[model samples]
Target: MTLKLELEQYPFVDLSAKVAEIIEDRFAIVLKSKLTLACMYLDPRFQCALDENEKKIAKSYLVKLHERMEIKRLAKLDASPDTDSRSNESDNSNTRDENENLLEKMLQSKCNQAKNSHQKKILQLLNEFDFQSERTPTGIDIIEFWTNNAASRLELAKLAAVLFAIPAAEVICERDFSTLNFVYNKLRNKLNDESLQCIMFIKSNEEIFQMQ
Candidate 1:
């Protein structure tokens, strides 16, 4: 919507219209990006910031994505070699743990009385969280929050890991070149590739180490 509004504010309607059309076409592909969707879904800040309707949209895609993942998991399981005694024991142990988890959730739901649907539960948690206030006071502990909840939110944690692994923008590579220019100036020309990489890593994440 903001992008649309920005385009509308352009002086040339014809150019804006053409640009908007291109954006619309590209935006469809962006929407289909599971990694982006997963990141948005798992990010506490994004969850708190997005409106209810936007949350619904993310949830709809995430649910479908989860289902697709499950299908792939089952296919992989079917393709695996037959389990012997050791594997069978491991399966039994996993089943026991799962049953225990089910019992615990059953007890918790009974106490709560009204179990919301998965979608609503996620949205409710997101909406109820005071991420903005917490961020202003202390830094946003997004990784910690996800890590602590990872056991119960296993799929979301997996999604978060995959999403976080993706590069957010191509500009990062361009920025690295800029860093290289600064690091490999006339006096530093003798630095080898390995040394350059070491310097780049330190430069890129200097603030994080500084904080520690």
Candidate 2:
């Protein structure tokens, strides 16, 4: 759109049409990625740009990702040694105040019910999310929005974290390789593997150390 406006203002500009065509081609290739499409659907600012069918496809992909994460979470919990200890501790608490025990049981039941309907919970989240509402401020941080505002919805928040952690481009990886070139030059070729890794770690996180 910006290029289109520029062309309107100065139609004789050399290679303007070629530049616009290249940009459009790159965008078309990006749109073919399901991950990119899903991210757009999740981002409130651009969600409205997707049509109904695209939205449905994005939602399905998100649900599948969430379900996979949910399975891994449950598997970890089941494998934990603490589970047996906690159950034994709960049995020892049977002699506590009757009303308090009843309340705990009720809360546990509610949590179990919530865990059983992960799909339903996701549907509810989609239905209830309204970025146009007064509660959502403009220029909000997407990661912070999911982590803080949706803290109560653990499954959704975890899914968002996993999705957003994926790098959109290979720039970071390329930067790392560039850094390695400087660190492991011909003069420093004798550096051992462990020493090289240590230097890289400090170099990569120098900004973080400075902030502290």
Candidate 3:
């Protein structure tokens, strides 16, 4: 709306041109970012941020991530060889050849089982929209909420755990820059990158010890 108003009032102005360019760049970044969509769905603050259409968009992306994770998990399971009857391998060779059809059927059944389980999880997430209405009597600890309910809300909890781990601002990066400067001075220039990182992590989380 601001851009539309600016275009109508200052169609020939340089500021309007700059604004248009900036809006286009920012819009492209936001539209291309799956993180933005994931954040919108998982963040309690954004429970009411998106309209119905936007919620649908968020849901599609969230479900896509969930399905992708599930597929990878199932693929890993499928790739794992059965080892239970390894001791009788020589005798089992003939049996294995005969049971190829049964093995294929079993593999198909497991794949279907995995897909069904994933679908159930997605449905649970969809039905749990009311999770937004559950008041956080004390305060908002989004990560803790999901972590505590992980057992019951496995898929949604995993999604929340991942999304919550992503820092929402550049403040942590800026702080790390300052810490790097302090840690890698002229006298400490020989510190390897690994050691520097270790020092920085401790410095950043030092407050955790103070809490005790």
Candidate 4:
């Protein structure tokens, strides 16, 4: 009877270990997603969950995202009408004496140095251990925390806004499909592709329109 009971329990013990291993493997795969890891790092509650290498990956992803956003913003500014006026002013200003040209070069050099220092500050903040300290409160709201505390670090706040906006599950996609079924049913089957796309876009962003 003792041998039979051991045999009966053996499969259950083996299954439990397999289940644990599967769960660990799933987590490893999820953490391997660069955006997911970056989002976790941005959340103060989960900042300590990452290992050193994972932290490095998350930081690099965030910096790249920030740089991309900065590039887009600069492009928009360059395309604006004010930029044309500024360029004309700069062209005319180039006719100044040698002393003025030297002053302008010195000012540009200082601006470049300031910009480099700001970038260094951002990198230093990412590497700091203070955020992982026990003093960070439990159950803090990630969005609110970044909004209120990261004013000086607008790049981080912008990245957090984007990372947090990404849906972590399929519920949103499922909901959109459900909405599509209702919007494009048997009676509405004749809706053209362009019209349907416009409708879906409006539906997906209804909250923004409502706010306005």
Best TM-score among the predictions, by candidate number:
2
| Runs in model 2 lying further than 4 Å from the true structure | 1-11, 75-116, 130-138, 184-198
Clashing pairs counted in every model: 0, 0, 0, 0
Q: What lDDT would candidate 4 get against the real structure?
A: 0.77
Candidate order by lDDT, highest to lowest? 4, 2, 3, 1
Candidate 4 lDDT, tens digit per residue, 77-143?
8775766656777566756566678989998899778667766766776666336555456678888
Write one digit per residue (lDDT tens) for candidate 1, span 1-212.
45876997884789898888788888777756645555665776555544555556666666565556655876998786665855776658978788879999998887455323544554454444324434321256667777887897776766566557667678888888898899999998999999988999999888899999
Candidate 3 lDDT score at position 94 = 82
Error of 1 at 189 (Å): 3.5
* Candidate lDDT (C-alpha), each: 0.67, 0.75, 0.74, 0.77
Return the clash pairs for model 2, or none.
none
TM-score of candidate 2 to 2 decimals: 0.65
Better of 3 and 4 by TM-score: 4
Tens digits of lDDT, candidate 3, 62-129: 77778888778879988977787676788879878879879899989998897778777695676575
Q: Candidate 3: lDDT of 22?
A: 79
* Per-model TM values vs. the true structure: 0.44, 0.65, 0.57, 0.64
